[model samples]
Target: MQAEYGGDLTQITDLDLLAFDFNPALRMRKFIGESKSGSGKSAPKALDRMIWQRGLRAFVGAEAAELTINSKVTEQNRKFGRELGVSVQTLSDLSRREEALLMAEVEESGSHGAAAFALVEWVRKYTKSEPELEVIFRFLRSKVWFLDSFTAVKQTISVIETLSKQWVVGHEDDHKKAVRWLLAEAVSVFSLMLVDICSEARLRPRFEFDAFVAARLADGVVPSSEMKQLSKSIDKFIAGLLVAAKATPAVRTGAMGAFDPVPPAYADSFAELAWRLSRWVRASDLPRQIDFLAHERIGLNRPVPTMAAQRIQLSNLNFQHSVSLVCAFLRGHAALSPDASETLLNLAVQPEETMSDAVPSDADVASPPPLALKRPGSGADEFRGQDYLDFNDPD
Candidate 1:
């Protein structure tokens, strides 16, 4: 069998090696060997002849037989032998100490030996440190052994951070209270995101108010009726911001920063809401408001418009509304009065009846089961006969 692209060949004969010369500009190299069929008696000798003719720098024979000096056939083997004057050895033989020594000497004298040795030394020096070795090991392990999904990694990191915080704080009442409030606020915002707003313009403001409600809930504050009213006003203000963003001339129809001219009344309303919420947020009892605001901005949910045009129109508006709500609260905090802030905090912190515990009215109660029938009808008669049957009956 003939092998291509660096393969071992053995045991064939009666062949002629033809070297073809091509144009130097073409840069082509070619070797052709041809063998003819012969008698079975001559076949063995033919095999020996072929083996002797095609000797290679690295000769791998089927039976691991050593080639005699006279048996060297190909110019490649002759060149290899002349360069090192080394005896050919199988890889298994070279793995042994004695043969390995001879092989090592041969490798040292080989054409690429110096370059290979330099590479080995370079790698040893550069990768000897613990950190370097660890990095290499990790890279190798990642590519060749371990496979991890990014989603799983992210989830694992989140879990680790959460668990670490919980462990550090343990079962402290204050920590538990904080966790409960956070959960409640998350649920509230999630609920608001699911709410269906009738007007497209109303969506951004509604989302903004939801964010504030979420922040208050996180602070362990129950929103009052006034707070709810203020949230609605804030939503309207955000809607106005959207309208202003839409009016900007430089803003692309579907690109960012299109909104620029918020209505004065809407801006005023937003400022008022921000001023009120900021005071509550800055109070000692609600110090986590900044964190809540950051989280809300990062996590704000946008509603999908029913059409492409609607989506393009709403995108910049939504963004403007979100920015206005956050910026107003951040900038207005210093202007709030101490007494007003204290009152807002007290209102937020005050215990209020939860929806979970709200009592049902009398109308909500089910009426007593309809009075039982005094007489049996056709439907009841079928079962009535069976009910009257007693154990005393005989076949």
Candidate 2:
């Protein structure tokens, strides 16, 4: 009855507290009753086993449905009917115990989707000796949202890059200013969207300035000193670009009076190949990818399909490459900052600690393996010492 009432649920820290919290027997009865009434379309038993073994929160509903259809004594899924009686309780218990805690933290943060992602990883790693799951979840969630925001900004930059190419190539001076203005606005949106995404997670305590610093630092793209200096320049550059974009039509028209040649559109037939490279290479190799693109230009009068192909090729770069490419473009055509260049350069040589996917725990390794860096094209073969690309400053 208490479970059906749907009152505000309190945290249950111990199994003892669960007794007073909800009637599991009644809940199980209702769940079983509902299972009997369903059409009983069951999932593969093996797939259900794999999902449960993985303990992924996103697939919890599917696992629950797997339990439901499996409960009915149907020919396709009778394999699970006997076990279903126990498995249903186990599934419900897993949800009831962790769901409230996870959801509460995510709700408080206001970035549920990203938080959900972090919580999954956190739950996978969290233990009694580890930091509180909530703290870990929130911390990782901030980092995850920063990554997501970075991706969004880069996607917008791809569009801006595409349109800018079109603007520069157009012989019509009448629309050149408008195109340049629109390009600038797109850059502003890139910056703003980054802020908006982080703010939604309450990660933007200092407007975008703090979050930007945090993201760059977390990504190990730049040292604290360089980021501090670079952040100021970046703020100014974004504001200046926005101002340039918002300039009066008369001023914009006057600015574009000089003959400015547009870069020729590149063909996208190579897009698929670029995608393959992006997937294979690490973030540090993104600049080289841009260099690869610089040589891939096609004639302005290339067929529509050819232009579309090139656009896809450019878009296929990894998220880091996309971000770096945008920064490279800005350095060439807009604000040229040593700080920006330094920061972008640093992205390729991030400290090992910062770049590592998992902190090596005593529980993780019986005999700790030597630290090594994997070469771009190498598969499962890592070597001692640094593996620096020609473009990356190993130091």
Candidate 3:
């Protein structure tokens, strides 16, 4: 864009709150916002802001705009805004939304926000005094959103295959460095997990959580469709063994099936929610859900989450969907059983460990843990768990 224009877009695109989500058509659905505080004469007026914002919506190709001001929004002004395709947000509206999101565990400090700024300062300070720190800091910046989310993430994901090794090699000498370094690592991991999640949706035409999830385990080693077929083959082979063991007088069918892996913790309690999620992904609600996730992130933390994605490649629908999926999952987290929560914590709760190790080599990723394939002894009613796939499948 810079080369095409012969100038940096940094100045022209300064319209506040230009957030976006991915779609197949334009490949982006953008929301622009303009905000001002205080109702004094010197302060920007609501009508004026909306007028300019409407123009900006066209200039940047945004589909929506929100104009926020301290003054009361009159009916006439609201009508004009509606005609102009910009929505109005008063201070009270923002407050109510924030109140809704307020949680005991959420800190006053921005969610992973201040840490990023501090790391930027720390890096600048170190590099100015120590020339040797240049390469490391550059590498670090390449991996982090410190330089900004869009460009940096593009660079990071392209080289994501080597991310883990690079992380293992980085410095973590002092307390501050270690903490900041680890935070960066976690953010990168967040990006990886996000990418893998989307990758599943991209690789296959149809949507099924288990198939893509299996590919995720493969660590991007095998095509998702192939992995799904491979898993089916494995299950069939195991089922044949189950029948064979029953034919032998000495052998017990249950003993032959003893090797069946236990379902992941909370697989039962999570079955309903997980099934809902899969259905939503495959349903019309997905676009709306993604839109809500994009806008809600801005409402949740002004700059924390969006900074990691803003102006990044629009083709990164996987990242966007993964983010929305994770947000949806986390939103329902409280409803999970306590043991399930503990299992999640013990699992890769940290951003750094979620898809922590980068894409695997030619070596295959293990298939998703299969549910117990019932042999002859148990009735279909006795069988239960996460395998409740589609409406067509026997419940």
Candidate 4:
């Protein structure tokens, strides 16, 4: 199967391509061509020529190879550039200002963009420190700090205002209150994680979570029973958060003035909440009842508690179900997942056409509705009732 962008199996093909053609001497020197790597031969030569045509070079260790002159490199470079935005040539030839702009643009494109931008920045800063590069680096570093601080302040004030309003209204069950809290938590957690992840800015072409997850699981000493418990807790927490988010008004309008729509901070809040919730779940003991419930929902034909009862085997079915549930919840709040967070950050840095397209109209904005739990199995009856209530009442 072709490797997806973020999948674990995805090789750093870009790096291999870079080394093979851009620095053939180095490739020959380092690997000695003894290894049966697929990229060691005619492919890199062709890619090199293609990249040379586009006026970009693959920058390899203290030297750069022009793409326009290298057919093999050029073809490969163009293909990668089409999806990633800028070609290898464009990245290498970019002026400090242009480089910054391109970085911002890539960051806006998607999570891949964010990763690429970080890699480029790291390379430009560490590989060779020209005066212009230093200036750009300093500016970027400062901008990142400013952006983070600004987001923190905005989030803090918003949370304070939300709490004050809840206090004044004295409506504890208000759906908006729950939504606001969820949003706040998500933002806080996301911000912290973003900072943590970006701190280790390396030129990694692919994002692999397997190693990270494996290390974390090992650190926690997670067992099969514990994993099941963690999954259940995460499911409940996510469900609650989603319920709250759905209830919160999307827009609020009053006689005096109209409140601005809730920002994407709600999504950020969700991501952050998930991260923290994961920690607690990881630590909790497995709940036998919840595991059984999950097994039934997912359809596992594993044996029930057998043997002397001192050791009841919790099947992998429960763990898998829990994972599926968490993934489903994350998908529902796709805009708030870690992947989405990266995309949002990129967008903030470099506004894209899609982001512009999603901009809402004045009338389209409204606060989320109250959290009305639908009775299970009611189906169309519940839908009709909600529709009637929605038409009959306006808040």
Candidate 5:
């Protein structure tokens, strides 16, 4: 991998050795800081700050990975690595043991050691407290466990090697802004890539890719024009997926068989609905909304009793309009097909007076059902409309 850039493998520096030795641990810390926080007894404010920092790491990692995989980026990386004296070695030249050690070392060091250092420096400088920085680092170090494979790690390192040079020489003010924008853009592109991959693989998306997008939109971090662009992009992605699904018989032949055309979690319906809803819902209220809905569903009569019981139960929820509005927004946004939207809307917006037993007995709403779909990533649960699309609901 190193020799691909035309550099002598033996001409390594102490700085390189130090980076290789220490960077992965630093990245592991940052990774935990940005991941979904637990309901642990730690201070919420500090944890919140760490989450964004972790996100920044992911952003950089994704960008580095993308560039490394691109042909143009590959050329640029090789050229730059050659100019910067980055060591390169052909796998054919190394003994099997040497290759194994090289792979192991890269795995240990992580893919973006320099980038992690740069980011940590930014945080350290921003926070202005050495002890506090240590605390954050220690906390993160304790938490991150899931690192990508060796090949993936190498790609991330290549990106770091290429981008770090520009960051090193550019004016501080300009580069800081560039880095900020680059991170955001990279994250957006990464999300698109994930959606495409999920569509192609016919695998249900198990992560909420739009959590940050929802947070940004809610916080007004994104400009109005940009929001419109985002909306358009989302529509286009859904449309393309639909077209692809239609054209490919293999795509329609789900994991089960050709007869089971629709993918799991109502792929063409609720998956898209939840994804788009995640992009639009108020981040703060989403969890509460989800909790309330899940409570209502869990409290409903077993086997739903009858159509009348279901409608009455649905109408009794105080935030029926909010639920209805969510369904309406999804329908208007084209996230739901006409038939699914109509069915969900009917359940959401039905009048309480129309049902024979609009009020459930006092015992009904208080009891939990035999089963509940409360887990966040269960594609089936989110589609039932009982849970608000959490989709990585914000900090």
Candidate 6:
């Protein structure tokens, strides 16, 4: 049993120390040492490491983090350590623990805390082998983490819309699967990053999820318009193809039916949809989303119910679509809005409703099942429609 990320000095935290306490009159206590670690002989950098560890503890969802250095920390650094909940120690502490009695205590608790992250690592791992998809893979790994959820999702949609032009028509199932798999993984990655960022922001009195997200997405500057023409071109390019269909093609042909019949919550354009999603996220509801995703991952252990995808005709998928299916659940329930939900559909221009009966009917999907069952003791019977919040309803 190795410590999680224990040997990697490059990581922000240390999970190796295995802490313990002794008490004769009561049960002995043992603590697993977990924290992000960075090295610096200079006091200021050490403080920065402490701060980074604080976020890592929350991101990894660890009970505690410890930062140990070769030299003692400054008096001021010690002060912040106490406030930040990091345990700071020097090299000499190991000298006090060369005896067998201490080893017995350490063994009693066995604080290797892999449970915190073992769940996520187990559910899914994507293998990107297609030469065309290399650009998509690189963007996900390199760019998505640094972005806000909205922009991250938007960029995801945009990139696929661009790459998908080369896809053969018969591969619509493959396309939808790929699109869904990417979005599902994106949500998981983005949510985990959100946990790290949100945990750090909690230290400030004025922190807001929206503002923090907006600032980060902007990266201290205005957002870009470089992709606007690209998005417009693809949407227009496909709209023309839908009209030129001389004979009925497969349900998946022409403009991708994957994104078509824009959900009632969408604003008909990418920019409008972005604004709608920006307004829907709030801190209080954010945890519910996290818990929602966690339980969602938990549910993947079982096989999906029959006819689950309904008219969309999605087959009972494996680990790849698990997180994304949960996200689509949230979108249907109005947790993640429709505009953002399109991200799960791979962000292509949807075909016109008249063009395809293969996709879910506009009215049929107008009400997907709610995100959850009614609570333990509540008799609330309100219908949670796709039009629940009434964002883009044409009144």
Leading candidate by lDDT = 3
lDDT of 2: 0.33
After superposition, the stretches of candidate 1 with alpha carbons farther than 4 Å from their true spots are: 1-271, 274-314, 330-395
Q: Candidate 6's C-alpha lDDT? A: 0.40
Over 169-221, each residue of candidate 2 has an lDDT whose tens digit, in order, gives 43545234333323433443343343233222222223343334334323333
Taking the tens digit of each residue's C-alpha lDDT, what string does model 1 give over 1-395?
33333437764542233222222121112233333334344443323433543453123221112323222235565455344332333323335854645544333221124643453344335444535343432332122111122122222223222322332222445333332222222322221211111111122354565444333322212334445555556656665675777755333333332232222223334334433322221111121232232222111111111231121222232222332333333234223222222221221110122112358577535634222112222242111222121222353
**lDDT of model number 1:** 0.30
Question: By the TM-score metric, which is better: model 3 or model 4?
Answer: 3
- Tens-place lDDT per residue, model 5, 1-395, is 12234645663311111111112111111111121223344523322333333344353332111001111123444454344333222223233645665543322111124543464455445434445333333222221112222222222223322333333322355344333323222222222222222221122244543332232223233544556567666656655676766756444233222221122222233334335434332322332332223222211101222232332343433234434544443344323233332322333322333234457777665745333222223232323344434445544
Ten consecutive residues with minimal summed lDDT in candidate 6?
Answer: 104-113
**Which residue pairs show backbone clashes in model 3?**
186-352, 198-318, 218-365
Return whichever of 1 and 6 wins on lDDT.
Answer: 6
- The residue ranges of model 2 lying beyond 4 angstroms of the native Cα positions read 1-43, 46-146, 163-395
Model 6 lDDT tens row, 234-312:
6666656765765355522544433222222221222222223222223223322333232222212111122222212
Lowest summed-lDDT stretch of 10 residues in model 1? 191-200
| Per-candidate count of clashing residue pairs (backbone under 3 Å) | 7, 4, 3, 42, 4, 7
Q: After superposition, how far is residue 294 of candidate 6 from its true place, in Å?
A: 6.0
Per-residue CA lDDT of model 4 for 1-395, tens digit only, reads 12223445653233222221112111111110101123444534433334442333322221333232122235556576444323344323434645665444323221123443454444344524345334333332222222332253334334333332332222333333232223333333323333233212111111233233222322323543455566566656655665666644332111112221223433343333333223222112222323222222111112222210112222333222333333334334432333322211211111122234466676435633222212223122122222111212335
RMSD (Cα, Å) of candidate 6? 19.2
> Which TM-score value belongs to model 2?
0.19
lDDT of 3 by residue, 189-212 (tens): 333333323333333344465543
Worst 10 residues of 4 by lDDT: 25-34
Best-to-worst order by TM-score is 3, 6, 2, 5, 4, 1
Please, what is the whole-model Cα lDDT of each candidate in the order they appear? Answer: 0.30, 0.33, 0.43, 0.31, 0.32, 0.40
Q: If both were scored by TM-score, which would come out higher, candidate 3 or candidate 6? A: 3
Could you tell me how far off, in angstroms, the CA of residue 25 lies in candidate 6 after the best superposition?
A: 47
Per-residue lDDT value at 261 in model 5: 18
